[model samples]
Target: MVLSSSLSHLALLVSLSANNVLAAPRPSSPMSLSMNLKRRVPEARSADDISAWAANNKLALEAKYGNTKSIAKRSSGQNLIVNQKADSSFFGSLAVGTPPVAYDVILDTGSADLWLASSDCADSACDGVPTFKASDSSTFQNKSTEFSITYGSGAAAGSLGEDVVQMAGFSVSNQIFGVCDQVTDNLLNSPVSGLLGLAFQTIASSGASPLWQTLASSNAWDQPLMAFQLTRYNNDSKATDLEPGGTFTMGATNTSLYTGDIDYNDIPDNDESYWLQTVSSITSQANSISISSGSSALAAIDTGTTLIGGPADAVAEIYSNIPDAEAGTGQLEGYYIYPCSTTVNVTMAFGGKSWAISNADFQAEQLNSNTCMGAFFSLETGSNAPAWIVGDTFLKNVYSVFRYNPASVGFAQLSSEALAMNGVNGASTPSATIGSAAATVSATAGTRDANSAVALFHSSPSTTGPIISLLAITMTMFISLRLV
Candidate 1:
């Protein structure tokens, strides 16, 4: 999740070039390196599976919203990849320190601060998880800066340190990051080891520089650019969960991965960290809502978030026009639900261009033979919070670029390969094997935060709403379902 350090400081990082001048753009080689990505679909089939995800999702929401009030008072926060499993998440592996100890990390753009569980950590969250042992690495250096960060899901305390972090063919030496000595159980069960934040340093909870910035400023590449081509998976099946077709490029945009021109949009001056943009309108065949013309709402193009969340009134309006769409239940009480047969058609406007979402992405989950969860969720932060947190649900349909020099984000139609395998289910046939070649790698993605307000939902009949904290909701309601 993103934590803004200076909420009112609306400016990009100063360019680190001669005389405050920018370096010459690299010619021909826009994206110098490319690595494949993997998709991780949540196991939410049975009653036990639903209960487990609900508990985990609660922790994620807590971390996402719980620390906002205290974040400013705290001096440190980790670049974390939380452990809750949503319907879709993507991650990649990298090596750290000398001799290269391998660890899978989320390439997140939501927040900045690199962190990992350390050998010293024995918290419930670190149980049975891989730890980064500083002593084992010859080049490891302990800065001994005590650090701590709280998430809605859990909390962590550790020390700051430096080491060499390598991905694909690129490497960054003396990379500053956190080593957790203690963490809540919510983080211990993550599918990946840590997070490598890609957003600007302005939003870093610890005020640390992001991995992309360090690599861009260093001699590693000629330009400060990164691009992503996310792949999709079939929610109905789990055979291709480890498929390795999605690609991430550093240094330049991969022309081969996109069709048509890459339309760029300037990051608004008022936004502090996230690659945020003001939405002009949200349109569908049934209706069109002028978001920007009315109340002026901003949407963060976040790779870390899982769903499209916004103010309850706005989200409710979007689903209200859909035929047979209804309110959800249990953990998703505030969210929308619809018949599985209904196909959703929605588009978001930015930079005067309309980007359409695929019907394949609208299916959040098959709740039963009649009902399915809508892809969109409600945000309790009201209209003041970012109007939308557009995640993979919309990103998989477009090839995106995050550029630093000009402080802009770009988007283009997905290439034929990406389009052929676009939607909740992409590949018709599953591959039998996955290779572990360093250059050709695969990743696992996940979402730690639940999109809706946790407090609004009622716990099981036997329990008292499962309210665990003072900040959480205490209202109770009972569902007749056996395990809901």
Candidate 2:
């Protein structure tokens, strides 16, 4: 089913225990506490952990994503790898997990809900795809509700069951999550177990209960929204072979996250689906670039994106910036291709200044000793599928933070200093083509204090809470732990 953003108010029923809240299950044993209660958040985790995890773990990357800084970092992705023993969260952080199954999740950031696809699905797509057998989990119970979730490129079909779900860094006892009976079609059937929708901010379906409202009104986390820093991925490598992307932080930054200037864009009370934004500017490809990490290119970005759309001509143009570049390849779609050995300096202009792609991002997945690929590319094919998705490929290059501001709407971009301080790492995932040089943004460097990250919490009287950074958003607030 094409999950409509409006389905929440239709039939969803979010019943909370504390009495004054939004939505699910009880913790398994005495050791597990509902995330709705309280738990200790990590304060000293490091990039070193991320590097070890990504390189060593099968599906994990060395990068960890988080909004917390006092200690560590991890590569947070938009999906999950569910296991029978996977921890669940219903309220607080006491029920978090360890190793690969910890609560740190890569969420849709754009959608809401803190659901896990349980293992009860009776479909073939469930074969290799990870599943959470609630019956065997010992902490499982049926909510008597059937459920299904959809994404631009994927979908999870299952039943709405109750269990203790692991969260941010702990657990949420008696949480409500999707127990999939049908396997997620598409590439998700291979590795990704399920999706953690971070958009809606609530576990919505028939009722308009966003994950954010449930948490905030429930007084769960200190904040509602989770912070992210996708170090960047090299699609040049196989998709299934994803690396530790970045750090999903919560509450703080590391010795590295400098305190910088922040710009916030407020979300309207009536509509959250419309990530509401004015046209920042039109790309050279004639595409309007609103620039949102939370908003997937496929769903929110394109007006004429019959297929995945992007800064069309800008892609070819940027590839040319790399010295001694080549033309393009693959679908003959004009995407820039290059050798992994090349050190390309790339930048994105926004506020009159350019954000640089760190050297790490510029590097390709290193296919063999001679071949490499570029990070940026147009997902458009001659097909009708909305194959579009503006992922870390471009975001990692800029300080593309999304937050709310008073008197403003939706989200806001970063300040000149906030962005200038963030530097580019490696060359863009190797590209197959090189077009023209065109114009570039000024490259004046700036720095922000480590403690000054753009915080997304709630305000009073506004019905929002302090953890999420706004009027109580939803779950999908996952941060992976890595050894970067």
**Highest-TM-score candidate:** 1
Q: Please, what are the lDDT tens digits per residue for candidate 1 over residues 1-484?
A: 0111321110100000000000123235332322222333444364333323433342343234323111011010001111112224454445567655655555566556778888887676565556788887887989879876654445567888887665434445566788888866544333345556677787666666666665554423344566666655544355234343355666556666787787778778745476777776787645886464433476667665555665667677888878899876665666676777877888877766788887766665565667666667665432333556666667767887777767777888888866664333332212111111111111111111123211111111122111111111110100000000
* lDDT agreement with native, every candidate: 0.51, 0.30
Give me the displacement of residue 203 in model 1, in angstroms: 1.8
lDDT score, candidate 1:
0.51
- How many residue pairs in model 2 have overlapping backbones? 161
Model 1 reaches what TM-score against the true structure? Answer: 0.73
TM-score, each model?
0.73, 0.48
> Positional deviation of 352 in candidate 2, in angstroms?
8.0
> For residues 1-484, could you state the per-residue lDDT of candidate 2 as single tens digits?
0111221111110001000010011112211101111111112212233222112211111000100111122111111111100001111111211111322222444344444445565565455544455544554667677676543333456667655443332223445666666643331322234445444432254233433333333323332333334332222222112222333332222213223433334443334442333223324222333443422222221110011123455456555566555654332233444666666665543223334555455442233354344545443322221223233334444333332112122112334433432222222111111111111111011111233122222211211111211111212222321111
